[model samples]
Target: MRHGKTFGLSLFLLAAGTGGALAQATVVTPLQQQYITAYVAQNPVPAATYGSEFDPTVGAVVPETVVLNQFAVRQEENRNWDGGQDAVRSMLYFVTPTQQTVLVEPGTRRVVYVMR
Candidate 1:
């Protein structure tokens, strides 16, 4: 009975820790959103043509055929826009046909954020 109680407590703690990590996932702030919008506007790139099958939501994997552009953070803009988070600096972005800017993780090709 004591062992069972210990196991249950351990499981609960593990689950709580996992939840905390998930909650810490990067979130784009309003300022960052504005910066992204302006950046996309200032620098136009060819939009990727993905049919209806493409899912732009977070956690969705981008197809290999689609090219991901490196998000070049200029020194002047980096300090103002990044909010001290290096995640923004390392991400890759691509514009969709609908003009939505999607940030992606380079390694996994997973969509991190889609700015409409």
Candidate 2:
């Protein structure tokens, strides 16, 4: 009985965590929506390469070939991409149709850097 309870609890926690992540992906603030809209307008994905589904894993329409396993938000550090040492806030990492990585600062919704 104790082992069963433990297993059930573990299952509950796992479900909750998955729900939370999915919720975060589907729901966005008004500001975030605006950012997404503007970004999409400026950088449209060609229909031939990507699907219409909005994939939060990469903060953009996912490529037909790639399956997004995870989406991460983290502070920036000095690296080859941006070269900024000060780690202040979090940013969104978007994967392009060409399999390139584009880092966007959520606040400004700016494509700060790219890794090809």
Candidate 3:
């Protein structure tokens, strides 16, 4: 038990040290904030209802190939390739409020991605 505790502490410290090195504070101007707000508003999370309904294990899988395939499908559908072009028809990975990784459709805000 003691050894496990020590190992955990060491791992924590190592992670903390690394993260600290990359940590920097940034101040966003009012203009920047407004742009972000407008963007968020236009892309309103249609799937907000699925915000916390994701399976805890959903995020554990390797999403590389699947995610790429989805992206390709979207890109093919709309050659110009905008976020809304993909809309809410495809699957996407997202972090739930509970910190669980869940699959969702960002536009329509559904959890159907996980079950698929």
On lDDT, the candidate that comes out on top is 1
Per-candidate TM vs. native?
0.69, 0.28, 0.24
- Candidate 3: which stretches are off by over 4 Å? 1-18, 21-24, 46-116
Query: Candidate 2: which stretches are off by over 4 Å?
Result: 1-89
Give residue 71's error in model 2 in angstroms: 5.7
> Model 3: per-residue lDDT, tens digit, 13-106?
3335443222121122333233333433444342222323333341133333222112223334456433332222233444333433334333
Q: Using TM-score as the measure, name the better of candidate 1 and candidate 2.
A: 1
Model 1's alpha-carbon lDDT is 0.66
What's the CA error at residue 84 for candidate 2, in Å?
A: 9.6
Residue 70 in candidate 1, Cα distance off native in Å: 1.3
Per residue, candidate 1 scores C-alpha lDDT tens digits across 29-87 of: 66567766777788889998776898777667799888888767777875665342354
Report, for every candidate in turn, its global Cα lDDT versus the true structure. 0.66, 0.37, 0.32
What order do you get sorting by lDDT, best first?
A: 1, 2, 3
Residue 7 of model 1 has an lDDT of 31
